[model samples]
Target: MAEQLTGLAGDRVLLGRTSTAERVSDILRSRISEGYFPPGTRLSEDSIGGALGVSRNTLREAFRLLTHERLLIHELNRGVFVRVLTVEDVEDIYRTRSLVECAVVRGLGEPPYPLQGLAAAVAEGERAAVDSDWKALGTANIHFHRELVALAGSERTDELMRSVFAELRLAFHVVDDPRRLHEPYLTRNRELLHTLQAGDRRGAERLLDTYLADSLERVVEVYRRRVGEDGTGAS
Candidate 1:
């Protein structure tokens, strides 16, 4: 296994199977998700490589991976940095989430969310919320929605949703209160589950759509507070 990442290595440990580049990517990814570097924060190859005992090539590869994932933004010469998530990006994400997930709920037959991987995901979210592990909570939140929508059984949709969730988690890192960002929805999620479980597909879909709309509004408001005209003074 890779050494326990601390100091320059940060929170992710290296796994033996992972190449130096992969390990570097994981560390950088985790750090970004943990809010160590906010959106638009610059990353230096020499600095990160030297700190992690990696090489420029390896760190470059890592940056490429995150950039592809939309977790990092690459510039022509200025260098890569965490994406300064714009209101447009945030809105698009929520819009896609609603379009996709609302359909998933509408498609469900009954009871279990049935991804063969959902209950565990929900349990993890509850644990993170209980322990106040915001990052884990974010991960769990993403996973829960994944399982919820995986019921639609579409590989393409699953891939798209995962991409959106990764970017959303980066946003989550900036918020001071994780639960406040998501806590208000747990009961709502439970209610949706109950509605689905009762074979009330119409009710579940309606509820989910409204919840998603309001949830999107909340996050976008916070995004505005942090990066919109009210905050960035850029646009």
Candidate 2:
């Protein structure tokens, strides 16, 4: 952990002029989303604070914020660790995504649609696939969904979904086979993108809704098998 932090040392602090806690939280959030802080990894205050050149108090505040967002959990005596999401969490996340993403596609704005973001994200996934970068492909998949939600033209909703995607990354980190989990989605995402690009709005909504449902089922099956009913990962 200290070595990891050392690499981040001397980097510009995020969101300049923000409060210390907020800035620390943003960096930590980005790290977690990037899969640097994998699920169940213990975060030592001394190590993290020393690495980031911040005080323990500030680090604790940042941890508290992430915990509130369900990205980390503090045990009574063992200290804070990245949260290990259960199968139930996966189901709920997909449910929320299905509702919100499907809604965005259904009510997408009229012609001259704001699709540059979506197109960029799709292109990113394609490049990742060409390089066989499974982890990056997964990240690009999340970006596509984020842009899809942006179609609704709601900053508040986009912010909410951002947190949702971060939590979703936790599940991704625990995946036993990255290719098995993300490869199929690469093609599906491209197909979905084309549907919208061709102005098949209705077809796009149905595809997205079905896509979320199928994804939820696949993730739940794999997750349950990997983690078991009580959330203790298979040993």
Candidate 3:
């Protein structure tokens, strides 16, 4: 099967009429998530295109798309580099995640919405963490929240969280240890599920808010330390 993207566009079936820009954007996004193009790393149009086996035009298009997302930033007279998110950016992301996600869980109470999917996602996160699969864990965590937002009963809401989740994946690049960053939250997630199962929607919402803030701080702390070492990184 072909790969997928979690955006307004969703999973794209590669077909006869797929645009080069879209394909290249998808490929480049995957590479960035896989720890290829890290923060502050410049992209040369021709070079990356040649390496990825795409044309320069396609690569440029991909770069522009990512730039629009704030994942990539352009410098005048220079090339594009992947963004190193600031603590402010981290807080902003958390704020948005909390707003969208907590609101999602607030509406879900006991025995109503099927939470089996979220439970499975939590398990997948743990298994992925144990396997030293940070990438998979990251994806699972995003899926968990994305599904949480799905409870808001709106596709538009789901799409909004999906974009944030994608940027969250990109932010994971600078993380030193995925286990330290995410594994501890598995229990809290389980507990929150139990609370929701018990019809404690308010408690679940509070737990989710705390979880988002704490998790955001953990990663931001790591990001800050790294940026300190480099001196020109995340502010």
Candidate 4:
């Protein structure tokens, strides 16, 4: 875990004048989404503050912000730790994703739909697959979905989906085989992209619905196997 957090070093650059706490929160949040800080790992104030060059108070505020986002949690005696998502959390995430993502595709009101973001994401996913970088592949998958939601042309919905994908990454952190978790989706992402580009909105929506449902079922099964019936794994 220390090594994972270490990779986050130099990834943060403080702007000329910015909210320190919020910047720290954004850095930490990006790390969490990238699987640098895996689920249930305790966050040390001294270590993080020292690493990121932020004061303890700022770090604490950042922790509080992440806690509110459901990415971190505070225990009574123990310090803050990354939130460990459950099977139910997995279900809820997919539920929300299906509604939002499919709608974005299904509700295209104009002939000229934006494909730049989606195309770029799909291309990145293909590149990640070629390199066999499952972790990068996972991040690319999240980006693909974010681009999908961006199709709706609403900042609020995009913000909401960003949080949704962040929470989904929590569950993804426990994946024993990242390749198995993300590789299969690469082709499907391309397929959905093509379907939309071909002007088959209804077909694209159906593919997305099935894609999300299959992914949810697979993720839930793997999560159950990892955490067991009582939600305890080799953490």
Q: Model-by-model lDDT, in order?
A: 0.75, 0.87, 0.75, 0.87
Task: Report the lDDT tens digits of candidate 3 across residue range 88-200.
Answer: 77767788988778877776645556778788889888899779886677777777777678777798887676557667766787777877776777778788778877877
lDDT of 1 by residue, 18-84 (tens): 4777778878877776678777789988888888987777788889888988889888889998887
**How do the candidates rank by TM-score, highest first?**
2, 4, 3, 1
lDDT by residue (tens digit), candidate 4, 1-235: 8887776654544431237888899999999998789898999999999999888888998999889888999998999999988788789899999989988888897556788898999899989989988888988999999998998999999888888899999998888998998999999999988988888888889999999999998898898889754346732
Best by lDDT: 4
The CA lDDT at 37 in model 4 is 90
Question: Which residues of candidate 1, in runs, are more than 4 Å off?
Answer: 1-31, 50-55, 109-116, 230-235
Q: In terms of TM-score, how similar is model 2 to the real structure? A: 0.89
Best by TM-score: 2
Worst 10 residues of 2 by lDDT: 9-18
lDDT of 2 by residue, 12-111 (tens): 4543323798789889998999999998899999999999998877888899988988999999999999988888888888988988899888887665
- Estimate the TM-score of every prediction: 0.74, 0.89, 0.79, 0.88
Select the stronger candidate by lDDT from 3 and 4: 4
Residue 225, candidate 4: Cα error in Å is 0.3
RMSD of each: 8.7, 8.4, 7.6, 9.2
